[model samples]
Target chain A: MQDLLYFVQQLINGLTIGSTYALIAIGYTMVYGIIGMINFAHGEIYMIGAYTALIAITGLTALGIVWLPLILVVALLCAMIVSSSMGWAVERVAYRPVRGKHRLIPLISAIGMSIFLQNYVHLAQGSRNIGFPALIEGGFRFGAEDSFQTSITYMQITIFATTLVCMTILSLFISRSRIGRACRAVSQDLGMANLLGIDTNRIISATFVIGAALAAVAGLLLGMYYGSIDPLFGFIAGLKAFTAAVLGGIGSIPGAMLGGLILGVAESMTSGYLSGEYKDVVSFGLLILILLFKPTGLLGKPEVEKI
Target chain B: MSTPVKKLVTAIATSIAVMGAGHATAEIKIGIAGPMTGPVAQYGDMQFSGARMAIERINADGGVMGEELVGVEYDDVCDPKQAVTIANTMVNDGVRFVVGHLCSSSTQPASDIYEDEGILMVTPASTSPEITERGYELVFRTIGLDSMQGPVAANYLISQDPESVAVIHDKQQYGEGIATAVRDTLEEGGVEVAMFEGITAGAKDFSSLVTKLRQADVDYVYYGGYHPELGLILRQARQAELDTIFMGPEGVGNKDINTIAGEAAEGLLVTLPPSFDEKEENQELVQAFEEKGEDPSGPFVLTSYTAVQLIADGIEAAESTDPFEVAEALREGTFQTPIGTVEYDSKGDMESFEFVVYEWHSDGSKTPVN
Candidate 1:
């Protein structure tokens, strides 16, 4: 009985972390969906969002603003605005000039932008890990001591709910809104979209902005959940989110969500059952296997290229 | 035209003469190498600051043999190849002494260049036992060896009478060496070794490993690696609801671990040197760090400060700026430091100071187990 409860707890923990991965993965998948280009700087934007929230909350708390919910909302908004600006700027300066060129060229440029943003953040924040205040305290107990307690925390629930709401709103906007259709048109055929009187540049820029805002939400949630933020925090999270996107289907919105959640849950189960050290090996190993077996991913649609 | 040529020649001669004079009275140069950029740049920065402080303080006190000690800083990036290149550059620049090469892999390779160049190198915090055991006369470290720290950590775990113990390492030379030592020592002491494994470093997820441990019914885990992997392990373990105690060597004593682990770090035990803040004699050093707006609780900060002091003491004792003489003096000399009395063996390793256990608190301070 105790063993069963432990398994359930581990599952919940995995799902919570998976939700964060899902959020970041959505950004990667969305950008890739439209441009057929990876936004390597997406992770750095996520890191910046966390730092932005940190600085904003620190400033607010110093002024005696102590309400937790109010601080979170304001911090999230600040993160979104800062990250969106960064995303748009990155597209204009780094991506736009070389768009429609060789595919590898833009990929290399993204890599360069990734390194540049990492160093830029390091210089701005100093090469140290800054601790963020916990958004919520105390664990949620599901049962009595003799029986078993679920051990879910308020922060975990909040992270899961926020990710679900963001993902739902994103899905709605893409499917029901005019801008969404424009984005889809661009992704389908950029030249055709231009022929149909769609502003390709505007749609691309908006895609970047929206994707970056979602990444910021992930960053903020990660900062609150882990209670720490550093300049290089994005590198690993970005890689994992990219992996999640590919695992779920690189250009599929729902696929990225499924991939992120699966990756997170798999990691949690591995850590719970195995040694914590092998969890990463298991995750990447799973990625390699999936790519080999199911190239289109679990939920991704197959794309046929014109020769 | 002849007169103009004469004027130009005279100006050139005068400039050459002044340059020669400056070279004759130039400062004594020492090289400091570490990861100036990378995840561990914090350690390098602290080292540079501490070395600079020592240089300033020593210069204010008339310097060694009336020559100002100047430091030449290089970024090794904690890579062996980069370390070798930096060592070659330092040697070419005529630096007689070196204070760095933080990681063991970097230090081991760089020490060869220092040896060939007859330049003495003193490491403040590189604790791998093999660093000095390679029979390099010019290489030395002021910290205890992993051979000592590993057993100390294992003894601490043994005292707890854990039901079962699992040991894991990051597969690096230093990480694996320390982990093996701890595992061997525990096994020799009759403790049940439930699992012994090695994992790749820089891995982001550790769920599978944690799950295996849970299945193995292990009550304690001893990890021998740096903070990155250890932090992830602690966090993931907590997330998995595993309540086992985790312990590691001094390599896991970094404040960055607390940052990465956050609340998950609470109750985790790490074997490190005694706390400098708790040492009554280190009160002044603590004040100095505070004045500089840096926390003294960081393991490397005090170690860096002590490294600077060691270099200055060597210069003073040798009464010369020559690397050979100063290194000889350092090997034989004893000095009081913030961590207490310090002395080096002929292998250029610290002969005194035993490792103690400390528990990392959620507030980022380590509490001594005593």
Candidate 2:
């Protein structure tokens, strides 16, 4: 009975972490969906978002801005703006030059951008982990001495809710907005979209900006949730989010969400059921298995390659 | 008359050259090896800082044996392979006294090179018992061995009267060795050993282990690992609502743990060296840290500062700039430090002091407890 409760708890923890992964994975999937290239620097964009939020909060606190909600709003906005701009700049400077050269070339360039951005942050931040203020204190406990209990803190709930809202907004934009249609058209066939009078460049840049903005939101929440931020934080998170994107079926919006949640839950469950040390190993191992068995992911549709 | 003039000139030139050689002999060089980058950089930084502080303080007070001390900082990256490279570099640089090689795996290999090079190495924080027990004469440590620390933790748990204890390790030398030591000691004390297991390091999930612990109805869990894994464990455990008290060695005494675990880290107990900052005798040093706008409670700030002093004291006692002479004096000498009176045994390990338990406060400070 106790073992069952422990397993259930582990499952919940996995889901919580999976939800965060899902949030970041969505950005990766959406950008990949539209551009047919993995935004390797997307993780650093998330890092910058975290740093931006950190600076904003520190600045506000320094100015004696005691209102918590207002500080969060300002920080979130700042993170999104900075990350979006970074995405736009990366597209212009790195990706644009290598556009249409070869898929591998752009991918390599993205990797280079990733390293550059990581080192840039490292040098700027002195390679130290900076602490963020806790948005919530204490936890809600549900059980007595003999009872199995789980506590839901505000930050965990906020992370879950924020991801949901961001995904909803993204879905609405992709399905309803004019730019969204253009993004989808480009994803399906960039040449066709261009031939049909769509501004391919503008659509591509917008997709990056939007994806980066969402990533920034995830970064901010992560920093707040973990109460620490580091330059290298993006690397692992980025890798995990990428895994989540792939797991959910890369290029499928809902697939990314499902993948993220699954990855998080899987990780949490692994940590709880096994030793915390094998959590990453278990998740990544699962990813490899899924890829071998289902190349397109659980939710992703198999793409028909053009002859 | 010509022969006399030539002899006088040659004598004068030879004397000047001899004096220059004498001047060179007036300085001693020691190697400070540890991770100056990567996740464990803080340890290396502290070692460097402590060595620097001691060097400055010693120099300001007219240096050791009336000669100045110079330190060469090397990055080991906490890897044994890198440690070997660093050890080779230090030996090539003629640095006979070394202060570090932070992790056990790194220190174990580096010590071999140091021993082979006839260099005297004193680790400020490496606590694996095998470190000194290997019977290497040139190697030493200022901190208590895992033998001492493991028993301390085990005793603490026994005192708490927990019905059962779960022991887990990161499977690394340091983690596994200490975990085994603790397990053996606890079992000898008639404590029930609920589970003994090994886990991979740098893993992100701990749910299965938590479930196992919950199922076993273990009253306490003692993890033999560093902060990263510990942080995730605390967070995930809390998420799974396993509310058992988690304990570990000094490896958990990192500010990063608090950040990574967030609120879940609160009330976590860890065993570490006694509070060096809270020592009334360290008031002046504490004041110095405050002057620099640095927190004295940081993991190795005090230890690092003290390492420098130890070198200075060794140099002073030797009354010579020769590495062999200074090392000899170090082995024979004792010095008061912010941490406490530090005296190395024949093998270079600290002669005294026991590990003390501390509880991690929410504000990222550790308070020493009985």
Candidate 3:
């Protein structure tokens, strides 16, 4: 019973973190889907989103806003707007100019954009981390009072619910919305979509916007959950989300989501049962195993050679 | 038409230029290296401000032995590779003395180059004993070792007579080393260590770790890491309603922890260098820092200032700009600084350095507990 409770506790912890990873992974998978190029700066966009949310929250507090829901709503909207603009601008400046060149060129450009954004934030905010106030606290605990217990915080619930809502909306948009249908056409074949009057460029831009907005929602959630924010906070999270994107099959939205949850659970289980020190090693090891066994990822389709 | 006259003019010009160049050579370069822009750059700000003030004051006091001390600052970002690069930069830039390379992991490698290249270094913040245990002659520090600090923390916990304790670290050189020291001491003191674990630095979540702590049922937790991770751990642990008392080393003593942990920061036990600014003799010095709108209370600031002062005094005592002479002079001489009277042993560590335990409040105030 104790072991089961512990396992459940780890699962809850993993899912909370994994849900945020899924949100960030969508950005990577979407960009890869439309342009067939990895947007390395996607992580920076997420970080910018978090910073914007924090700034908005601080601003709201200074303006004597005491309502919790209103504060969170305004902050989320601000983060999404700022991050969407940043994503669009990054695509215009970094990815668009170098597109259709050597595949590595845009990849390198994305990397350059990532570095530029990191340094830009570092200078603006100073290198030190600032604390994110925990607006929502407390949680539900299970099990006997004297024995080991499983617990979940309100913050974790917020993260999980927000990700679910975002993913659901994203799924519906992709399946039923006009712009979403155009996005699918563009991702399927950019040249063919252009020939078919799909406006591939606008579709690509919209994909970036959608991905950035989701990442911003994650930024706000994770920032509050973590209780701190720094300029370099996005770098490691970005790498992990990229790994999730690869694990889920690049360009597959559902794949990214599943991959993120699997990776997070694996990490938490390793930390809980084996050792906390081996959690990262386990996660990365899982990535390598998936790449070796199923090179296209668990859900990714095999690439077809162009005639 | 006038070859002899032109030759005379050239000689006169050359002699004046030589005289000017000779006069410019009277300045001694003191290299100040640390994390100018990185996660731990807050500590670097303290290091820089302390060393800068020392240099400014020494210069204002008619310079050291009629030679002006000039500080050359470098940013290592608290990274070992970057510290090595900064060390080489110092070597090539003609820097004979250095005051930092803040993190123990960064300091250890940078000190090797300083030893090999015949440069004198005195770190004010690094506390890992391995740095001084290597029998390096030119390496010195104005801070206590983790060996001293760990025992101080352990003895305090033992006094409280906790039923069980959990020791945690960030798995870095400084963090793990101190955790090991604390664990060993607690064991010797007949305390049951419920768990000893390592966590990844820069990781945001600690819910699993907090759950483990609860499962262990420890009454106290001694975390050996910086403020950021510990802050999150504290906040999360509080949210989980784990009633364990927490303690940490000087690495987690930053005021920013208050912001990160919120009310959870209250009652945190931190072992830091003695509050030198509170001493009677340091009032004027503290006032000087206040005049410049700098806080003199940080553990590293006064120690870094003392590092520079020791370097200047060492040069005067040796009466030579050679690092070897200054190092020998430092080893042999005893000088009074803001922290205390300093005397180096054979390993270049202080003969006696005190680590004081303080109870930290959420309002960014700390009161000495032991």
- Top model number, DockQ: 3
Candidate 1, true inter-chain contacts retained:
0.29
Which ranking of candidates, highest TM-score first?
3, 1, 2
TM-scores of all predicted structures = 0.85, 0.83, 0.96
Report the error of model 3 at residue B306, Å.
0.8
Residues B1-370, candidate 1, lDDT per residue (tens digit)? 6999999999999999999976886587768889887666767776777666667667788876777778789999777899999899997899888888788878989999899889988886688888898788778776777899899998888888877799989888788888989999899988998888877666544645665666566879999887777887887678657788899887777767777777888988989877666688878767876787866766666676677677778878988767788888888988987767788888888877678999878666777785
Q: Which whole-number lDDT from 0 to 100 does residue B52 have in model 1?
A: 68
Cα lDDT of model 2 by residue, A1-307, tens digit: 5555556656656676777778778778977888788888988998999999999999999999988899999999999999999999999999999888889999999999999999898778766566677665555655556755545666667877888888898899999999988888999998989999999999989988988898889888877665567787888889999999998899999998899888887776666655566777888998999999999999888999798
TM-score-wise, the better of 2 and 3 is: 3
State the lDDT of candidate 1 residue by residue for A1-307, as single tens digits. 7677678878887898898999998889989999999999899989898899888889889999999889999999999999999999999999999998999999999999999998998888886567677767656666556554557777788989999999999999999999999999999998999999999999999999998999989888888777667788898899889999999999999999999999998887776776555678888998999999999899988897866
Ranking by lDDT: 3, 1, 2
**Lowest-sum lDDT 10-residue window in model 2 chain B:** B202-211
Q: Could you arrange the candidates by DockQ from highest to lowest? A: 3, 1, 2
Error of 2 at A10 (Å): 2.8
lDDT of candidate 1 vs native? 0.83
Candidate 1 docking: what grade? incorrect
**Each model's DockQ score:** 0.21, 0.20, 0.73
